[model samples]
Target: MGAATTRATRGRRGLPWLVVGLWVVLLAVAAPFAARLGDVQRDRATDYLPASADSTQVAELQDRLPGGETTELVLVYHRADGLTAADRATAAGQVAAVAHRHTLTGTPRGVPSADGTTLVYPVGSNEPGTDEKKRDAFVADVRRLAHGEGGLTVRAGGPAALATDASGVYASLGGPLLYTTVGVVAVLLVLIYRSPLLWLVPLTVAGLSDFLARAAAYGLNQAFGTTVSGQSAGIMTILVFGAGTDYALLLVARYREELRRHELPHDAMRAALRGCGPAVLASSGTVAAGLLCLLAADLNSSRGMGPLGTVGVLCALAAMLTLLPALLVLLGRRVFWPLVPAHGSTPVARRSLFAAMGSSAGRRPLTVLATGAALLGALALGTLSLPGTLKQLDTFVDRPDSVTAMETVAAAYPERSAQPIEVLTPAARADAALTAVRDTRGVADARRGRTGGGWTEITVTASAPPQSAAETATIEALRHRLPGSHVGGPSAQQLDLRDTDARDRTVVVPLVLLSVLLILAALLRSLVAPLVLVAAVVAVWGAALGLGGLVFGPLFGFHGTDPGLALLSFVFLVALGVDYGIFLMHRMREESLRGSEPAEAALTALRTTGGVIASAGLVLAATFAVLTNMGLVPLVELGFVIAAGVLLDTFLVRTYLVTSASVALGRRVWWPGRLSRAPSAAPRRVPEPVA
Candidate 1:
């Protein structure tokens, strides 16, 4: 009998070490590939475009042409008053020097603005071919030559130059993003745990999880030809640290409780995992399912985000559940130091903030519920104030040289667009397409530019400013008149982006709702609970967006909202916001199952789980808030909405509204579940509050 008991004990102790060993081996194998992930991230416009977009087709065809993609630029030399004789001579000498230094399609001609303040030189070269690095190098060389001297300002602006600037920003994101996320998570964990030693454990585990997620993402890309971008990759890292540390906090909180009840550290951890594992699994599963719904989106960036985000979340879950437990058990109770939970001890009694909140909520459940709903409804109205769809030149938080030059041309040439729209048609029908383009209503001029690969390229300049309604109408006219021809270029791509975003929202939003509902229904075993949670999150989303509308233009000075902002922010907030809902509801259900009265169960659940949920919400919000510091306007908007939504959901919606709703609904909140049918009975005992 003693030998049997000893064998069982050995088996129990052996498993955690075995799990740790396997993870170590996995990390060792993944290290090399993970380091290479950054090298493959592509941030070009084509990477994010819809697969069937005309711009995408044009880009692909251009890549297959003899010289590959042509590098296009507009060199703008500006003088506030007017160009002096020397300024004109300087411009002429530099244009000659540029032509002499590098290969050109033809002799560049200078077009003088009617105002006589700017000289615009349209330059094209195929020297960079299809290589992004070489293209950036070429643009850098040209920019060096196009410099301001005295009162004249020379700037390089065009599609190629803009791509170079964007790529530079993407390249710099890796180190700063990672370091900032880690630093943020570490500080939050330290503050939440309030223990010098305990915070380090979870932060370290989160870092390891981030590394593993990157490794897995790289593997997916290599095996499946997955599209990877800097934006998606950066968001994935944030999820790893944010979501992983969240899970860690829950587990650690539960483990601390279990330690006071069980005699042995190993036994206590087993109890902790048993207590919180399903909630953690369900939370992570819902987030994963919600993100995976992005695969239904037509946009490349949105689709790619689905897999990368899922990888980050799942990796974090794995590390926190397995590695965290192993480390806790090995380190024993001493890790908590000055505030350790000694064997056979009970937690000290204290009046927690959540307890006070629950007491107030329980007193007037319906009033609280109504007030919260009204507040959310009021906030949702802010959406009407949001600015129009963002312009390409306004996508960056700080205007780059390309945007400045584009602006200069727009101001100088208000009657005509600065950039040309590219039309690719069959070589046999070149004359027809060219004639059709010229005859288009809003076209200022149309000219045959390049012909190769059985295709002919025609460049059309709009009579209106770029991305204006008039320019868009002209593009539509060209597309309608010319069959088997694609209308492309920067303006066309922006139009395609807006259209795709609308299409993606119609498809992906419904899919996310359905996926989250199914997961919650299965986890909570109730139809009403899932619906309540979904409705709450949706309200939170509307309010968050409305708040953005209020501050985006007036407060932050963001001119236009990103096309993808609404959809991306909705997915993240719903998935992540519902995370806290699951934690609270899961506990509420557990209390009901233990035979606590409905009101008692709801309040107890809030009192017990509220602190941890608040901590997790803060961590998640702070991590996403890091995106606002990035250079791109879309990222900034996305970060702000999500961070704001999480805070709203956590403090107001989840705590006050959800708890009060549960209290008001009583057993009906768990409709069709056995607990709802069971007669009201006394709970076994009131749980002691943990510090």
Candidate 2:
């Protein structure tokens, strides 16, 4: 098979300048169209979440109600001494006057808190159109006027203001992260390769892959009508760089090894492609397959992420096979300048940490395996305390605009400031149902609005945040207690999100496992090997989740689990963790076929493949660790867990569990029609080393 692959590569040796030219032409044609797609989505948020869901109600309520476009500014007026009624009334009148003169719609709807310390104004926008910039300007103007006037500390926050704040944070954090990641990759490559010319190779390939991915994603969006965001753009960057570098390392490492094997430069290149190419292709396929499975998720954001990530991985694979090889072929030996040319004299003969670790694990497989399992089990204990809340406000660290606005509304008008949960009763008993709901548990107030004909809108304002579990339970109770009514509101929406995410996890995990198992089985032609690898991966996943829970629960006070955690964790663990296992098992099979006993083959495979796995792990982990600096908690947690998972897989599972399992299974590892007959155990003279 290796010889056949070598022959296939040897058949094509010329520089493929035409391919490069075509790539250039494609990019040139796609860039403008891609930019236009982004613009269309940016112009219409409703295109993502259509307000047609409320179109009828919005039109009916348009005349009698205060306009919903107003951004509420919470002005907390505090005095060192207790506030007099005169002071309260004076502040309210002043607020109303300013609001009236500024063309702020309606009067300042002032509601003083129970303690009379804080006053809230539910102000609406005078402008008819809902322009975000105008709303922002109004908030800024309100803030400027309120400052130091009445010894008041005016904290203006709402959806618009919070989004503005988030944008600022993203802007501030994004530049440094980009520079840092690029600089780190550049410096690391230069240091490792020790050649300035060679250091630029991966970055160039990465940039091209990124360009292709963006262009492809743009095309996909147009074809499928998907919306991509700046957030997804960040994810795309990490995926391209991480996956591209991994593929490049595999090819480069193999190329160097082949060159050392006394093969001519061109032969070595081809040989490297033959040996490493299939493994690289297989690894990339698994990643792409895993990412594409995200399409099963109900959320548009999750669904969008699937193809975006898949495009990045596929682009990386394409660049690796085509662009990277072309560049290497053009540069030839110059790619490894200044380093004495390496000769392949028994690649695993030299003593190193990986060799030593592999020898130990091979000698004491049981002890090593048992210890690793125990440690992972200890970490898994943290999963017991995992919370199941999906509060968007919790994503913010402190005093983010959305949270502050929510708090302000809660303080000012406890009854009106809270978001309502709609309880839809049957039209036949709509009036009777409304009376029952008003008396239901946790209901602060209830109002029934007729939407013409027979349909009625029963709005139940809860005394808690719409996303709180208590609110969730309250909504559920209302559904059960008022069994005749249809319950749908912010609370109902939260329930829907929770249920959908749960369903996605249940469905996607098995699909990812099955896909990985089938890929492994096809590659190894051994049912047992794939099943063992899958089991090891599942153990690794459980350990990762447990460790993640410990870190997030204790350190960050993240009591409530983000609903996305389980699904994201499963994907990362299965996709990334399986790579190390594949590398180990592939080499084990190769060594086993080379006339070594199962245990000896396990040791040899471990020694030969461990360094590659570790190096790949470090490179991948470092790239993922960059996510920690993105100012998003989910990304931070993901970065940590994924980085840790890769490290664990390389050092523990692949090195220990896989080796032990292979040794224990013996020749049976190739059960159900052996792919290759095991070599006879006969002593043979060692041939002179190549070169």
Candidate 3:
């Protein structure tokens, strides 16, 4: 039946082939347009925060309060001997001259460090609304002034400087990262398949996935006003490469297996699809759904990444099911060139090591279960002490202009350079709220203004930098002090992050688990199996997190643990982990239906499916581990955690969890439906050895 289906598919492959080509062309047409959507905002951190009272009430409150653009150009003067008073005066004069000439806003105030090694000139923007281009012009003018009358080695470092630096870093890193990912995946394919033709299949499929993903993103952005930034682009690349290749491998491996069954080439392709397609689709669907959960995230960047990653995975699935099979039919028999076919032989019995491991695991399920649990528990201890910092300056390897400017501003005018905190008060109580915030701990100063009718805005400067835990705590405390007034700013953004992290920890895990359990139940048609599978997955997930915390927290200097990592780890472990469980359990059920005793069926299933599981796990683990090469700590931690989680799920969880559950349940494993008990009249031939 499978053979006939494949042959029929081959006869009608032209339509799918055309569809694949059309997708390719569409993607190509959209590529350039997609590439131009860059992060257009300066101070993206500020943008990520909720609208502050000052910004919301700017029009009505403009006249009564100090300008919102309180910050002027920050000046840094340095010499080998440290800045002298004369150098400070000279730098201040230069800053004042530039500010006066440009008629920049706010009084030009000179601030020098206590050590006298740094000085800052705050030249405020001229009007309430200075466009970015005008600010850029002002920055350029300041640079020229600071560098005039002999090379004083003065450099512009502030919000403007940081924006310039971050842009350069993005430009330098973006193209190279994309090229390197492609190059690495290409080289790996060549090494693994050893056939240029076969290698190109995965590369082509990956490219197609990328194109579709981008087009989908463009469509989504156009409709929803959501944009994908350069940072998210890297994530899209990885999702396509790792997931697309994994799906391709499943199809190719199954195709080879069917070929060994003496099936005709076209028939074998269809047979492979029939056997593997369901699993691949299930895996991709779970992953895409898991990623899509990021839409609930408060951060726009994170929320965008969720859909972008999902679209990529979905495209990869489409390519695997439609495009890849068609391509395989076109390249029939030549897919595994230079390797002679091994005819009429089941490859399973010939592998002594795998047979031994399977037999041992099947026999001593308790020992295997206990050992795996212990290993995972040890690793999970690390997660308890995970840090939660997301400061860019702390994370980036090289100081970008923004970070340098921040450091300079910190050194020169610690009090004045503080990020603004906006407090909103009811018009009736505006004066009281402003006075309360001004006296709050860590607040350097505060000023208030009534916008109109029922609201007032108070701008407060903190003694501490925004986004710090201390700053967040201070903001929360101030909010409490004001009673009814709302506090929002960079500090509020931090508060939001803290709240999001808490919600993810408490909510996302349970939701993901429930989703995975529901998926397993539907796939297996057995509540008992899904329950055990989800439990085992949770164990593996905890262990992976605990282990990652130990490795990343204590050994590495990265104190800020990425909040997104936990959610990502949970999704991968549950979704991908369940895949292996399904493969093994499905074979076990088939064996049982053929009249083998539960124990024998379990052994047979393990011997047959264990090798494929291990191989797939290694490929996936390696693919995820490659993310470390991106030189980003978050990526590195994500790579390590995900790879470790998958490894645990594959080796420990699948082997012990599924096998033990099968043993313990025996006939009851298929309870409520008794689906595993379907009898076959024909004698089962010691399970024709796995190839």
Query: Which is the leading candidate under lDDT?
Result: 1
Write the residue-wise lDDT of candidate 3 on 1-691 in tens digits: 9999878766665655676677668778878756654433222343332233322233223334444333234556655446766676688778777767776655667666676666666455644233444555666667778752333447676445544444444454456665676776777677766776787887787777776777677777777865465556566766777778878877776787887775456667768888878878777877776677666655555667778788878877887777787777677777678653455656544754556766777777777767777777777777787776666445454554446656766665666434567676788887778778877888888887435446676778788775666677677788678776667644465466546655655665676677776776777677887787778888888887887777776776675776667776776667667767877777777777778777677777777777667766766676677666655566777777878888888777776667866775776777666655655354365643443
Candidate 1 stretches greater than 4 Å from native:
7-11
User: Rank order by TM-score, top first?
Assistant: 1, 2, 3
Per-model TM values vs. the true structure: 0.98, 0.84, 0.84
Q: Candidate 1: deviation at residue 310, Å?
A: 0.4
Q: Per-residue CA lDDT of candidate 2, range 1-691, in tens?
A: 9999877666555445655667688779867765553343322112222222222223233322344333434455544344567667666766765675577645666666776666655555545345545655666666665543455445555444554555444444435655666776777677667776887987888877877787788888878966575455566667788778878877887777777775456677778888878888888888888888887775555667788888888988898887887777667776778763555545434465666776777777777778878887887787776655746555554446446656656655554435556665556787888888877777778887443344555767776666666777777778778764566543465466566667778888888888898898888889898888888877877787787777776786664665666787678678877777777788777766667777777777777677667777777777777876665566667677777777777778887778877766777777763634555575232322111
Taking every candidate in turn, the Cα RMSD to the unseen true structure, in Å, is: 1.4, 5.3, 4.8
Q: All models: lDDT?
A: 0.91, 0.67, 0.66
Model 1 scores worst on lDDT over the 10 consecutive residues at 682-691
How many collisions per candidate?
A: 0, 2, 13
Highest TM-score model number: 1
Model 2: residues >4 Å from true position, as ranges?
A: 1-14, 33-107, 124-151, 158-177, 227-231, 261-266, 340-349, 387-390, 408-418, 422-436, 448-459, 478-492, 675-679, 682-691
Residue 405 error for model 3, in Å? 4.7
Question: How many Å off is the CA of 369 in candidate 1?
Answer: 0.6
Candidate 3 to truth, TM: 0.84
